[model samples]
Target chain A: MDNKVHLITEQDIHAYIDGELSGERKAAVEVFLAERDLPLERAARYLRNNFDLKAVRDEVYRDEKLKSEIDRLLARRKPRRHLIGASA
Target chain B: MTNQANTISTEDLNACLPALYRFAYTLTRNDDRASDLVQDCVERCLRKQHLFDGQNLRSWMFTVCRRVFLNQIRRDKVRGVAVDMEDAPQSKLSISAFQEEKMHYQDVVESFRELPHNDKVVLSLVAIEGLKYEEAAELLEVPVGTVRSRLSRARSRLRDLLENSGEEGTVVAASV
Candidate 1:
């Protein structure tokens, strides 16, 4: 809770939150983020807006036509997996 | 021999049309050309279905579509056709001014389009298609490091574009 601005860089914050940092580096980033003015909510927001792929997920799933088309194509290529009853 | 192969390949083409068309659109940025390119790829894929294995069908179709488009670009250099817009239908462009200004989404799309084809492909594979770097690397026949670098640059470029498009600090944070 020291009011001093955190020495940790934004990249450190990102890496720490994303579990990219490890051991002492991870602990140091956590402490620094806690001390800095950047709140937990802000940190969460930063990760979401910058790192999440939700936007693209929506984009890909938006058009029913596209999904159906892709599924159709994939179904066509599906190999006949013979599992049971070979002589049926 | 030909009939069974043709039927199977036609089904494959029908199923893969959306992804193929979208991939083509991503490459060319022009809907009609994308459609034509995808059609050409489907035809080629149908003809060559014997070469395809059942694994990674999406990746195979994407590879074929991309190669076909590039091939057309090569051929068009020698025998140019009229670039008419009336006959072929266009993509459903999400480029409304209000929408663009409101969310800067159109700005992002344009910035993506402005990037080099390789960059665009890398970005779309990661950002849009949600493929892991390894998967994307396999699809693009590039190293995983290459995909990561491309994605980093593409994300930085997108941020720059959004900032420049007068939508700084307005990025909607994901809730989940």
Candidate 2:
């Protein structure tokens, strides 16, 4: 391991929090966060924000009225079928 | 309609409705406009069902929603109708009525709404919708690098917003 300090980029920190970093880079991020409080707090905030946003989306997704409305709208667009001998 | 065109089942389309709506809401930031966008997209999906390749219905619907939104933006621009981002409340209830946790969540949502449109979409895709960078790129018809960069910038901006909102120290202290 290189004893020199590595400056953690915002991208790297985010990728680390997002689990996009791998192998050596992941380990490096872990080390960097272990020694820092601010970035770690920022990472925690990011995670918290992600969770909160997903909660809001979940509430939106479960709106029964919206679901029924979408269903009704799609139902109205179904192809019209005609009888074989029906006049124009 | 062609006899040999692929078609997606209504059930599958319905299943993807919530996600589609969420994406639309993130883009338009208005309930009525988001509903219109979703309805239009669904109408097109039904009308163009035969054209679907049937690989990823969710992604296809998302692509449709995004295209519809972009087209609407163009038309609105030509007609001089600006889509106001701050016209609607972020949530239905008053923030004061909620407990501390819920208030925090609402604050986050408010801050999220303040982000740029592109940032909101990118963050919604990767952060809220849990889409991989590659998957989001494909849905947005952009390169993977673009998604990554947008997500980074969005995250940084969100952090700044949250911090400036005066909740950063509280959030950190609470977590600690």
Candidate 3:
């Protein structure tokens, strides 16, 4: 060990895992975890959570009927131009 | 479509459909309502396309979806409907494999959907939507600190669920 004490908190770990840490802070966090032999499992778990969530959401989007309806809505003509173009 | 080049196009709307529907489903927790919310959100996005900065369409769409859901809840409240509760009838939230995918994915989805509403909201915004804490706070109208706490709690709960279901932590890690 280099005999250096680094202050790492719960929030720091989360931020680190979330990819929100700045370069310097992340390097510091890396050293802190390295000293303690941490495997960055938290980051992996969170990424897996995200991947799982994506897989689930993709399935939700697979409803072809619903997808068609949304596409139809998007294809509809824009609302009538204001009172200026009224032809009764 | 109007002559304004700034207007949201059919292509743009189509590209965002999946993400918008996913977020809408997260909000409503029901197929019909989620679809309605998404349609309503797209309609609003069309009408208000002029207001869009055209920088981040995904973020803008999410903001509008959140607003539309809240507005719908408010309208329900005015109509004497309880806006404070999830529609208990749909609480079961069946995730039957309507697709060719295996049953394992459905189980994972159910585990995700069974979390508390706030937990789901936090997770969807941060994990699924890929928004930063500040952006999620902007969307949720809460402080960044609140998003952080909810994220932490949501992830912890999700881990517990995965572990209980034998979702394979090391396997997930390797895949991710």
Candidate 4:
């Protein structure tokens, strides 16, 4: 095992968690994180927080009222096939 | 009829409605405005159907939605309509009993609302919508690096807000 301590910056940690780092740099981040407890915990918490926020935001898309309203609007438009058939 | 050849099918348009509405809601943060934006986008798509390729319909719709939102922002700026708390619609998520996770989620949503519009847009596209960095960059008309940087800043700010808010213990009582 190499005795040298790898310095992991906050951005490096964020990128590492985000899966943006690659190859040797990624390997280095993994090694560094394995040796540290606090940073690893912090990265895990950040990821969890991101997932939680995403989950909450996803609720907006499930609004049945909005979906029905949009459906009503689209239903009003004449379908292209119908128009083509009409013209024929 | 002139644009009939390139028109999106009603089924296809309906399939993407939820995603389109979600993106609009994130950007506008107002239910009424988001509904209007989606309606306007669907109308424009029908009128300019000749411009749309059959594939990539989702991305095309997202690009159009973003453009419409930006244009509206520009118009609002010109008209000096400052978007403030008073302009914000009612809270869509009702906070019930003070469960820990619910409180945390509520704090997250409140902090998310406080982010700058650009930050919110970037974060929503990449994080909430699960768009790739390159895709978000393309939609936002910025380089990939800019998206990364913006996401980084947004995440950091959100973390700060969450931490500080937790310390402040500003959790409101459940409406029920």
Each candidate's interface RMSD: 15.8, 13.8, 13.3, 14.1
lDDT, residue B58, candidate 1: 49
Q: After superposition, how far is residue B129 of candidate 4 from its true place, in Å?
A: 1.8
- Give candidate 1 misplaced runs (Cα > 4 Å): A1-88, B1-102, B169-176
Task: Pull out the clashing pairs in model 1.
Answer: A72-B15, A73-B15, A73-B16
How far residue A32's Cα lies from its native spot in candidate 1, in Å, is: 8.5
Per residue, candidate 1 scores C-alpha lDDT tens digits across B1-176 of 43453234456557766655655654444455566787788778778777765533445566566467546644542342212223123322223322322244345545545555555555555545545455566666678767666765655565565457765434222100
TM-score of each predicted structure versus truth: 0.34, 0.48, 0.45, 0.45
Pairs clashing in candidate 4? none
Ranking by lDDT: 2, 4, 3, 1
Summarize candidate 2's per-residue lDDT along B4-80 as a digit string, tens digits.
33887788888878766666655554455667889999999999887776555665666566568658766654543
lDDT of 3 by residue, B1-176 (tens): 22554677788779878867756654453466677888999999999988876645665676577678757755654653331234333432232211212344566676776677678766766665556676667666789999888888888887788668764433322222
lDDT of 3 by residue, A1-88 (tens): 2455568765666666566677557656654533332233454345445655754665533545533543443344244346233312
Better of 2 and 4 by DockQ: 2
Model number with the top lDDT = 2
Over 4 Å off in model 2, which ranges? A1-7, A59-88, B1-98, B168-176
lDDT, residue B145, candidate 3:
92
TM-score of chain A of each: 0.46, 0.57, 0.45, 0.57
What DockQ values do the models have? 0.03, 0.09, 0.09, 0.08
lDDT of 4 by residue, B21-136 (tens): 76665555445566888998888887887887554566567657756765766665454333233332232222232233355667777777777666766666656655556556
Docking quality category of candidate 3 according to DockQ thresholds: incorrect
Which of the two, 2 or 4, has more lDDT?
A: 2
- Cand. 1 Cα-lDDT: 0.49
Q: How accurate locally is residue B148 in candidate 4, as Cα lDDT from 0 to 100?
A: 79
Q: CA RMSD for every model?
A: 21.1, 19.7, 18.7, 19.6
